[model samples]
Target: MLSEEITRLIGKSGEPMILEVERGAIRKFADAVGDRNPLIWDDEYARNSRYGSVVAPPGFFGWPVKWDSPMPFFSPIREELITASIKAGFSRIVDGGIEYEFFHPVRVGDTLVAVAKIADIYARETKGGTLVFSVTETSYTNQHGVLVAVASQTLINR
Candidate 1:
């Protein structure tokens, strides 16, 4: 069961955090994921492609962030949400899923601003146990003010 306090947290929006997209970071991430796609790390290959330049893989959109200063990244927005849940008498938390809508490709040297908001909260009874789900919506915008991507993530806690 979910408490009213937690329910109140739903629809709460957080400040936007700036995420720098470096070409090196993109290449390293590609290497780490074993994704040998040249378009993701090779400028020459990407130049030959329609994109005409190196771009990040879709998976980077869901990269994990840490609890830092001024603003919070949606990927790790649960930092505060987890605190609220624990205060609401929840103990464990796990990722349910993520749904992403990409408007533009993440290119190197692009700095994006991401804002996270608690979209919803609900309770469900499963064969395993009772679980509470928190849905968060993270919107990403580039320095050009272009809406780049939006991610809806569901977190399960018990």
Candidate 2:
């Protein structure tokens, strides 16, 4: 179980992230994921389609990470949640899974704004120990201010 202070952090959001979807990046992602869809790569094919332009794949939302930075990606609220869990005596962390819901089409050259929040936190007792589950939800909106996607990720601490 989490303390009141930690529980109070539910729904607290971190800083908004800005991401740009580029044609090259989308194509690279599609190739990396072994998806050879014409809409994701062939500009000529995409231009003839209804979108009239290359559209990003269903799961492609952000650009590739630059590894030169000292820190990977920082989320203050998420860090605080992890610290709280550690203080609660959890030593091992495991990634549960992530679920994504797309509302609008994400296209190449579109800029996306994403904000993530702690949605829920709970614990379940098992034979080994208590497993604390933390769920975070992120909302992705395009430059037009239209909500494009929502991703929920779960982390378990044991």
Candidate 3:
């Protein structure tokens, strides 16, 4: 079960993080995933595609790292939620699932801004034990301020 403090964190958004969609990063991600799509690796092939440039594969959102900031990529709100969940007796954690909605292709050289928020917190009872679930929703926008994608991830804690 979630306590009041933990539940209160729901719907609270974290600070926005900027991520540059570099060509190398996109290629690397595709390689790591064993995706050999020409659009991800061949610039010329991608140039003729509808996207008009090298594009990131599905689920290949850019990383959020700040070279100058002392703070890590994760926002304070996320850390707080984890801490509170642990305090509430959730010891083990597992990824429940992830759902992504893409409105546009993520092309190389495009800047993406991501903002994450705790969408919900709840608990369920099973034969093993009570499990707490937290849902996080992140919205990604392009440099032109166009909403590009939205990803929702669920985490389960026991």
Candidate 4:
């Protein structure tokens, strides 16, 4: 059974992170995702495109937070925040899905600031198993203070 105190832990926030998008990172991601788009790797190709210099692909912002490093690490900010909102005893945790809305195009050299928090917590019993669902709403803004993206993650803890 989940405790009331833990259930009341909704709205708790985790450490905020700031990330800087880099050209190399964009190229790496493009390659990893099997995107052979010349614009992502070839400067000459991207120069003539509407986005100008290499632009990051959509969902690239879903990657880790890198302040100045060439490559970012999975910080698990959403998972950590959700953990604090759930009581002990969950056997498994899996990502249900993420609803992401992009407000601006993420470009190389853009610095993004993100904040993640536990928005809701609840539990239900199903024919398969009893599970707790934790939802985290994270909003990312650019250094210019303009909202860049919002990612809502639903985690199933069973």
- Please, what is the whole-model Cα lDDT of each candidate in the order they appear? 0.78, 0.83, 0.85, 0.74
- Highest TM-score, which number? 3
Ranking by lDDT: 3, 2, 1, 4
Determine the C-alpha RMSD for candidate 3 after optimal superposition of all C-alphas: 2.2
Separate clash counts for every candidate: 0, 0, 0, 0
Q: How high a TM-score does candidate 4 get?
A: 0.82
lDDT (10s digit) by residue, model 4, range 1-158: 56775576578775678777888888888888899888778898888988887778877753455443332432355545445544466757787898999998887778887787778888889897778887878888887899988888888887
Write model 1 residue lDDT over 29-60, tens digit each, in one string.
88888998889766798889987788888746
Give the C-alpha miss distance for residue 55 in model 2, angstroms.
Answer: 1.6
**Candidate 2 lowest-lDDT run of ten:** 64-73
> Runs in model 3 with CA error above 4 Å?
67-73
Task: Kindly list the per-residue Cα lDDT of model 3 for residues 1-158, writing each as its tens digit.
Answer: 56897899999998888888889889888889899999988889999999999988877777765733344545667777888888888978888999999998888998888898999999999999999988888899998889989998898989
Ten-residue segment with the worst summed lDDT in candidate 4?
A: 66-75
lDDT against true structure, model 3: 0.85
What does the lDDT come to for candidate 1?
0.78
Name the runs in model 4 displaced over 4 angstroms: 62-87
* Per-model TM against the reference: 0.86, 0.86, 0.92, 0.82
